[model samples]
Target chain A: MNLIISTLRKDDLYNKKIIENIQKNISNVEIIYTEDMNIKGCIGCNRCWLVTPGICTIKDDYEKLLIKFLQSKQVVFITDLKLGFVSYKLKNIFDRILPLLTMNLRFKNGQMRHYFRYKKHYKMGLIYKGNGNREFLEKWLERVMINLDGTSIGTYNIENEEEILNALINC
Target chain B: MHLLIVSCTPRAKEKSNTDKILDELRKGYEYNGNTTETLYLYKRNEWESIREKFYENDNILFALPLYVECIPGIMAEFLETLKPKQNCNTKIGFLLQSGFAEASQLRCCESYLETLPSLLGCEYNGTLLKGNMFAVSFLGSKMGKQMVEPFYNMGKYYAQNNYFNKEVVNDFAKPEYFSKKEIFLSNVVSPLNKLFMKVFAKKLGCKGSLNDKPYQNYIKR
Candidate 1:
């Protein structure tokens, strides 16, 4: 199975551990680091959805990442929350999903609520590495899941490499 | 009149589609007798300190590239901190360049900016939505290069003869074509990515919330 991991920041310890574990268990998995992305802000032009349909009008590395996402069996986003909110890095990428919202899908609080309903269901994961309360994460994740049409198949908390490793192996 | 144009994108200098379109507009207006100054907002952290200049200008143009469905965080922050003095009289206008073919997102921004002039009691001139300025698939594509031509021509005519002419304003506010099919595709594809991100987070042993989960680097204030 092809695995793709996209992270906005590179210096987070929890993300590093997750990447290390993926490297150990999953071989030849392709990862895209959005922190390295060079993108112009969307010009509020609806060209991607209106003209090209399913394609972004801005020429940047987003297309490359989207291509990888379409072909991969699994996709991941690594982010640090700021006071119960996604990082600016994460938020920017999330916001770019505007084009995707126009498709035939149901979203809750700006996240995909139903994911598994698609013809193919891919494994999903999240690595939260912050001091915020865990309850905040759960509530937010539930909202995202509502839109995704899937549940968290596996989960691990801050600095829990062993539990995540076990979950990955079993899944 | 001394006019100020703020370009919000980080890459306003190189291979920047927004900058190219704004540049065309600026060139078109230069011959109209107004001294225009363009500033790249990302380059200066002290954007707030320049508020005084807005007071001095008669025409103010806010040119932006959309980030997600909203303005950039920095611009939002800037707007929050901007307090126009009582009786400030700068006429406000907007010019937006987007890679998309339709101008739907501009409405959201217009809704936000509409409050700007009202709050400050300034005249709301109008907004120009330039669509299909660049193709995200090939930013430097030939069609992308030609997209800014009309903006340049119109801006020149407006600047020289009619900066606030009714015909020019109407033309600038002209709506571009849009498609429901593309919108559907985007809506569908987006959820797929969000679902993948959630599963990926679970696999990594994330601790915080799924929708707005925290990364390790966000530990500090």
Candidate 2:
């Protein structure tokens, strides 16, 4: 099983501790870091849908990361709570996923829905490190999960590392 | 009288916060004796043609939803390409809508707020900060309808009286940089943002060009 962790915090001990715990629990996981990947803002261009079906036309890290998204068995995102929402860095990635906003998706329940279709179902997890609005974050997480046709096993606040780790490893 | 409204929502039919505010503004000011024309940027086929339209209009109002903590990328580009002609007498005003209920997003339009009057040589009217009022859950409810009046009044005040005079503008506090958390996010994410957005031209599909990549990356992250 492969896992990917992306976060907007670097060199912070608190965040580092959480990352280390995640790494320890899930061995052989490849991390695609935010600092190294350098994702850009989505310019609201629909080229991903009109020109290139099911793929983002932007040639930068999105293309590379899209491949990572395809290969990974589980996708985990860690975000700092800024005003009760994901940081703008994470928001940019979410915005760029605009290309994936198509309705041609195939759901596992033998029904078709409108979403960026991936070939299979993958487990999704969110680690919100800071104390932001849990309610809002949960709604957003649910929305994004539904779009990808993936199951959202759980969301954890970094303060409860032990509890969250237990949930993640078990799920 | 003709009023030109420039809307910056990416989806043409989608009801973004900006769109919702604009719709309300449009309805409130509809029978005030002017023919209003709306130019949705996402639907505009040509970039330069819109700039040409800007020069042609006398009263121009800009409406955009705040992204991250700033203006959308296309709005910045639109402002940059504007060449205010000698005959251009556009009276400019702004309406900003954002999900976060803070004045921080005002920074996104800092340059436009400062330069619109200087370049266009027109009066800078006041701006309405429609904060957290566009949620679908709030629509058609009395709370939603009543809250819109104050914002409309603010717009009417500015439209009727020039509000961005040097003294008036200066009275407001100078813009602040990102909070400590924002700084951490920007530093970590700006590099990848640059590589993913600029170098690869992944943003080519968008309407306008956001040339100030580095600064924008910092603000965005």
Candidate 3:
């Protein structure tokens, strides 16, 4: 199974086109429109690591989504760039996933980062829609991959439905 | 020059390391006969007024901790509220501090912050990145006092020159990349530290289940 978490607005034309293409090409995929979800930003309380021990203390829609994340073989993010980075809505989702990683630090690629709690390795991709700097996004994604213990298959700038479809199919 | 310092931490002013550093910086700015104000970004109700202050100020500095290799979610949300540049001549700077001992952990977010000035139509005044900053909270202790002096000096230099001294910034962000010797030492010490932490957590009734998958039961698709 694959999970697609999108921060695009309901009426966005690009979102519509991308969703249509994914529906036609992909199977056993779950699409989450993040704006419609009841998710809260992480408060950085350290409860997930210290108190609850790999459980987010905040009760919200994120719990269900996190479970789906672990079960899925692949996860993709479709977001609009804000200041050459992920939008606040998408970043909020990313921040709330700290429980997916253990508090233990390990060295990977010559940098220290938290170890992943899950055994499965998921392929990740970013499909961004904006005129933001691509180099900055690529570097940020590279760091993200290292931390999450995921492989970055591709990062695509929205041009057309075919481009989006190809990226999804390849992933 | 009117300076607006935004301390972006989820914790309250008294408990935040970033706020403590900004406080010292504010002292330097005030010492130079400059007016300064601080806004704690977690005060969500005051965001509108803070935005107005942001527009009214000439120099804006963001002091924040690095979270998950980036700025905190609240900071990102605050950045979203800013309207695109409209004759705004604000000079923007950042003070990014992290708990990680290696300075390299904070470099990726530094690049992201550099791009923010362009998005806001402000001049980039450079960023100050510091690592192993968990000690800033113990300001009364000797180690804490030593850790904070560099920030105080950087703040004073900025107040006098209207920009961070490149030498001071570079010195403060020492060992930009950790050496092999440091890496080896960390690798040797990390496991022992983890073992100690596990024992401590167990004593706190948390047990050694720090790596437990609590959501295993919720995996039904």
The candidate maximizing lDDT is 3
Model 1, range A56-132, lDDT digits (tens) per residue?
67788766654454355555566664433345555455445544433223433333222221232334566556644
For model 1, the local distance difference test gives 0.55
All candidates: TM-score: 0.47, 0.49, 0.92
What does DockQ give for each predicted structure? 0.03, 0.02, 0.57
Model 3, range A70-163, lDDT digits (tens) per residue?
7887888889988778888888888887898887886766777788877767577788998777777777777777778877756778666676
Give lDDT tens digits, candidate 3, residues B1-221: 77888988877876677877787778877876788888988899999998888877779998889887788888989988998677877798888898776778888898788778878888888888888786576335566656777676778778787765557777878877777787889899987978976876676578547888877665533
Each candidate's fnat, listed in order, reads 0.03, 0.01, 0.53
The superposed Cα distance between candidate 2 and the true structure at residue B139, in angstroms, equals: 26
lDDT of 2 by residue, A5-68 (tens): 5665577676788778878887767776787776766654445643444556567777666555
- The CA lDDT at A150 in model 3 is 77
Question: Worst lDDT window (10 residues) for model 1 chain B?
Answer: B212-221
Flag the better candidate by TM-score, 2 or 3.
3
Give fnat (model 3). Answer: 0.53
Model 3 interface CAPRI class: medium
Candidate 1, residues B1-221, lDDT tens digits: the string is: 56687776645455567777776788778856767888776665657545656666667787776554435544543444556556766777777655444554355544545555665557776666655554432345566557676777767765654345545544564543334554567676876855664554455454433423112222221
* CAPRI band for model 2: incorrect
Candidate 1 root-mean-square deviation in Å: 14.1
